[model samples]
Target: MDITRRRLLVLLPAAAVAWEFVRAGTPESAPNYKTSEHWWGMLIDITECIGCGSCVRACAQENDVPDGYYRTWIERYHVTDYAIERPQVESPNGGKEGFPMNEDSSGKNFFVPKLCNHCADSPCTQVCPVGATFVSPDGVVLVDKNYCLGCRYCVQACPYGCRFINPKTNTADKCSLCYHRITKGLTTACAEVCPTGARQLADLKNPKDPIHEYLRTHSVQILKPHMATGAKVFYNGMDGSVR
Candidate 1:
């Protein structure tokens, strides 16, 4: 293992948090938390989203994302009923400032909030020459900025256009589903701050997680299913016109 990575491994088990004691059914003598027990993902409900930009704002605040770039963003789409024309999409300043009203009123409109799909067979991880980008045991794709070469291969490889060069750190950057918080047994900042509950953090491996019930009842779809990346962020009530 890389020496810097070894240091991170050592820190995770030693660092203490108050929430560690809050877990029920965990005896005082229980073993350390295992990453394999939890596989992280997200759920986005297109119908429930109001384009309020709360998730985008919360993500930026929690992650310290720089201006003119977004870790998560809302896109407004105006689509026609017929397959006659291309849909109009707008994401002003990555929708952090909310949106202007639609004047055309010719077709249905919806808000689509997008982030790193955290694909199981992630292209970003495959193209990283220095082993900086990788999928964790818990299924969250992460970037070890210390190991990144700023080569931008992963940036181009990501089909979702989620990856970007963090000018401040000079490394590839995208959402980790708030890995720092989720590993600590808390929900993601975006999911927690969403006023309408449009976005949700999902633990696919947990039998008790509500995501299992939701998935069973809803006709969920992953973005770009043909790419076959095993994209985990499932969308409910997604329209066919959405790209």
Candidate 2:
């Protein structure tokens, strides 16, 4: 059967150790979603991004994302002679950048970081019949590989088309925002690798965090605003017409 590839292609390793733990444990012990206090999110500053694709490389290295698949990617929108026609966008190195700069022509380029929106009312979790995917108490949406039946309903329902079934494990996967790394008192690999400070990881509960400050200062919008999934990912300076 020809499979519809709906997600980025990166060659990250399977979560062999983590999956073992998940399968061995009972689901009742899965952390309650309401009691957690912090909500993790990222603020993407389009103005600051240089289309360098450093974040993409960092995420792949840190998470072992598969060669063709990406946990995060950069979108470089290039406008050309065609006005009504859409801009050309490419994901070089799974969107880590390093493309030779094309001469400035009729095309104008802008860089936008892309990732799973991690919606509060995510359509992915809604389609999971076995309760494999769930929203964490801290508001980080994640998938329980143990409970996942390799059903691709979440992949089909996601508007951003960010979810993919792992080739090694045959389960749906996407950016967890480095949930394992974050819970261990470390920043996400992408955020850590961002050279221009374009990506900012913040605790939504922190009144003093810069994410709130950025939102207060900049014009921000989430991807597919009309979807109404209450997506947590926020993009500043995103062009409405561009995805």
Candidate 3:
């Protein structure tokens, strides 16, 4: 073994033990108390959406999402007889005012909310070499930045392409379903600020929640349901072609 490198390696075990003891005393070690059975999800009503971008702004403001990065976004689609096209996708700064016009002769238009779906069998978690990316007991997918090696594997494995590597933190980041806020008994910023209630969050496991009610009453679809990751996000009145 190289002498210099070998000496450094020998000290690493002692350093790791000291680091763990220090971290254990910090506030971050606070117990993660919870009572939920599974991860909750939202049902977005596309028909009710006016292409308003309120959720986008709320998410940025609430999470301090970096410039050119989005934890949540809206996509506008114009469907026509000849073809379907996306007119506007992301306007990070503007809220409801950022909605784009269809400008198509077909006059068919709608908006869809896009975010991390927190799949039960998430490809992101599977590809993470370190245990940084993991599914919570309640089914929420999360990234422990402290453990993340910043390999960007989770970013590439995401089918929704929702994950992004944060330049500031040098770690993979994505929607946490507002894990910090939700755990505090507050609604997600996107759901809380959504005008017209187009986007709503609730527990799918709880049949009493409005999301479950909507699922029972309407034909809902998940993005790429055929992938069978058991995505919890539901889309109401979504065009089959969009999937």
Candidate 4:
């Protein structure tokens, strides 16, 4: 109430200095996020998947995907005797819950988790007339919702049926390999929640990543190699019947 000009000036500078200190003490939003430094990919170990659908549930909760649509899902493949080529695939509700018991025990049953391959030469990106869909420098395929025309060109171009039109945004949507989380140094939702360690987030650009060793020792393959999309999601112990 009795402050002079001199007191006001001195207090103002001190308050400014205190504010700067507080800002410095706060955790940085990002210390050093370099998108170009990491090339992202995923590794799904088919043998390890138990059809529990934990990954599917986690992804749905993390992404807030609409009902009946999935950024990631699990398919239960039933290969009957001598019917390896035409395995019966079923994913009710995108496998959000663990599947019912298979009554037909005559055949071998396995679960395959599916998601955006995030191809290096992505057809979805190529067919987008507005360039809304793009592969990041780190190899994650992402869609700019604001820039998308909602024409569904990218949806049609995708061979794996990964891309879908978001009901809310009316724009192309798919897995960014959890780019928001990964860029902040966290694993994808699916990978993090997997109880069997079946799902793994990989950085191909990092030679030290366990994916390299897994590839070296296991017979890994990409879905639809003939599509030549340079798919980064690698499957270990994948059956031939998977499409």
In terms of lDDT, the best-performing candidate is 1
Best by TM-score: 4
For model 1 the TM-score comes to: 0.87
Please estimate how well model 2 matches the true structure, expressed as its whole-model Cα lDDT: 0.78
lDDT of 2 by residue, 1-243 (tens): 443443212212235666777775654555322336578888888888887778888888777777788778887778765653577777677566556676664656777789988888899888898999988888788988877889899999889888888877788888998887766656888888788888888788868777887788888889888889989888887765577
lDDT per residue, candidate 3, 1-243, as tens digits? 565977889889989999987765644454344646546777788888875778887888887788778888877665665555434343434333576444554646667788889898988999999899999887789999899999999998899888999889999998989988776667889999887888887776666677766778999889998888888888889985564
Candidate 2 ranges beyond 4 A from true positions: 1-35, 81-85
Between candidates 1 and 2, the one scoring higher on lDDT is 1
What's the ranking of the predictions by TM-score, best on top?
4, 1, 2, 3
Please write out the lDDT profile of model 1 over residues 124-177, one tens digit for every residue: 999999899999999999999999999999999999999999999999999989
lDDT of 1 at 205: 97
Report the number of backbone clashes for model 4.
0
User: CA lDDT, every prediction?
Assistant: 0.91, 0.78, 0.78, 0.90
Question: Residue 35 error for model 2, in Å?
Answer: 6.4
User: Per-residue lDDT of 1-243 in model 4, one digit per residue for the tens?
Assistant: 899999999999999999987665543553466787899999999999998888888888898888888999999999998988889999988888889988896877899999999999998899888788899888999999999999999889999999899999988889878888997778999999999999999998888999999999999999999989999999999988899
